[model samples]
Target chain A: MARARSEERRAEIVRAALEVIAERGYRGASLGAVAERVGLTQQGLLHYFPTKEALLVAVLEERDRWDTSGGRDRERWRLDLMESLVEYNAMRPGIVQTFSALLGESVTEDHPARAFFTERYTQVRENMAEVLRAEFGDELPGGLTPERVAPLLTAVMDGLQYQWLLDPDAVDMGASFRDFLALLREDSKRSA
Target chain B: MARARSEERRAEIVRAALEVIAERGYRGASLGAVAERVGLTQQGLLHYFPTKEALLVAVLEERDRWDTSGGRDRERWRLDLMESLVEYNAMRPGIVQTFSALLGESVTEDHPARAFFTERYTQVRENMAEVLRAEFGDELPGGLTPERVAPLLTAVMDGLQYQWLLDPDAVDMGASFRDFLALLREDSKRSA
Candidate 1:
């Protein structure tokens, strides 16, 4: 029961952090506000994560944790990635916004999420490209390296989120992504 | 000569505003600091753009104007677009960062730049697709639409900018964009 309660508190802190950071941005968000959101004292919140940066890292991890558990079926990764994107955009527009603000600042060689984002982008792109390679076989053109295409895929996802965050109707992640995939396939043939 | 001096002052104010906003964000940047940067009184700064919003709008418009005139040759639009992107990522990183922050807030139904961004995205997408259509002949397999393709182009450009801003070396915009163009050509070939 103690361990379970601790887990609950951690989750609570992460949720509160997301709400606070979303509203206040990375620079403005404070432990006091997050604690207040959770009905805990600042000191109490510190028990879970000693520093604000830790809490931020935790919050991002929690978001990705939920994303990781989702889309279990490898066969439908494309569809699943698209669906997860829509759900993520709906559930936490602020997180996306905060990310857009912090993205440049966070890319330093020492930034906490640098490794995570780099690896995450790599893995997701390889997965998507492999699916394409398998579907089309050798006829699938030559130079379509996963490294080459992954950035485009990742960029579309990130860019579409920005657009959707602005005018939800102006950007359609799933449709746009599917169209890109189709276009990618077509482009592969043209170069063949 | 008086009008030329006034235009120069306006440019100075805009430059000062961009630096202040980059350091302090849209909210933290104040008229006083901007005025000080430009060696003008607050009233003088206000003479050009009366409100913060007006100043921001002017900054965004200036960015648009810069984009329109800077290295954007019409003959080889694709190469021009690619080189322009590389130059932008190198020279005006602050503009990209500020634009990301403002983009979220500006997309409301009635923000001053709402129509501007909306039309800008639409027009840019169409223009890009026309270039692709011209290169690939109007019909391509998978029944791809230019409307669909254009947004993807913008998404990749916008998204890649965010990533590159974070980690300058994460993806090479010129190389990746060039690769995308190659992919587009390959995809145009069909199974034959």
Candidate 2:
């Protein structure tokens, strides 16, 4: 029972940290503010997360956990499933905003989150390549290998997010993604 | 003579501000730090630009100036020219980093740079549409209008920048952009 309570408390603290970071950005968020949000003294918060950096890592991990839930098979991800993922993201603006903020900051050399995002992209590209290879053998219809196209796939997803976040009403990220997918399908048809 | 010298000093300050902002991100950058980089007191920097927001606007405008110089005709911009622009950007990492950082921050509702980027993208999309119409016609190869494809064009450019900045060794942003262009060309040929 004590262990379960501790786990719940840690999850609650991570949620509060996400809210604070989303509103003020990572650089602007403080441990004190997150502690207040969770009804803990700063010292109590530190007990849960030994430092601000630890709290940040915890928040990022929690976000990944939420995204990869439902035991969705990664190797079977298709265009429709990718669109569904984009739709799912549309429902969670706070999480997306927090992610964008950290991603933007992580480009700098010294950011604590830099290593996390770097590894994440490397993995994301590899996973995307695997999905493409499974769907299309060695070469996609455009004669490009999955390895060649994986970066573009990741680019479109992230790029669409930036535009959508800036002007959500104007940018239909899901539709735009579907359109790109259609282009890929069209290429396959022409080549075949 | 004094007026010319003052203009030169203003330009120099803008350059320094870009460096500081790129290194520290917008939230972490301070006017005092920027001033110190350019050998000015904070008061002296304020004398030139009364506020940090004003300085930020100046930095953004200066970047645009650098990008659009050389009198390359905008209405006549073709795929080849667009590719050239991407190549040019690869040569200037500092400027690209500053622009990316501001763009990421401006996604937040209240950032001072928000209006500038929003307006810039709106104009950019329109310009891209014009370029496509000139190069292709009423319809691109895939049957979508140029207006429909403009945002994706912009998205790919910005997205490639993010990935390239994160891992320059692994990502060739220019080559990836060219590959996207090739896909568009293939679409055109099939439609033809």
Best by TM-score: 2
Provide C-alpha RMSD values for all models, in order.
Answer: 5.3, 3.4
TM-score of each: 0.72, 0.86
DockQ of each: 0.28, 0.44
Across B57-147, the per-residue lDDT of candidate 1 in tens digits comes to: 6787787777666425555556456556666556656566566545644533355656656766766776777766666666544467666
Clashes of each: 9, 0
Error of model 2, residue A158, in angstroms: 1.2
Query: How accurate locally is residue A107 in candidate 2, as Cα lDDT from 0 to 100?
Result: 77
lDDT of 1 by residue, A52-143 (tens): 76787777777766665654655655544555666656666667755554453344335565565566555666665665555555443335
Model 1 per-residue lDDT at B33: 87
Question: Which ranges in model 1 have alpha carbons more than 4 Å from their true place?
Answer: A1-7, A16-37, A42-57, A70-142, A187-192, B1-8, B15-34, B42-57, B70-80, B104-119, B187-192
Local error of candidate 1 at residue A94 (angstroms)? 5.3
Quality of model 1 by C-alpha lDDT = 0.67
- Over 4 Å off in model 2, which ranges? A1-8, A18-30, A50-57, A70-72, A189-192, B1-9, B16-30, B33-39, B50-53, B70-72, B189-192
User: Residue B100 in candidate 1 has what lDDT?
Assistant: 55
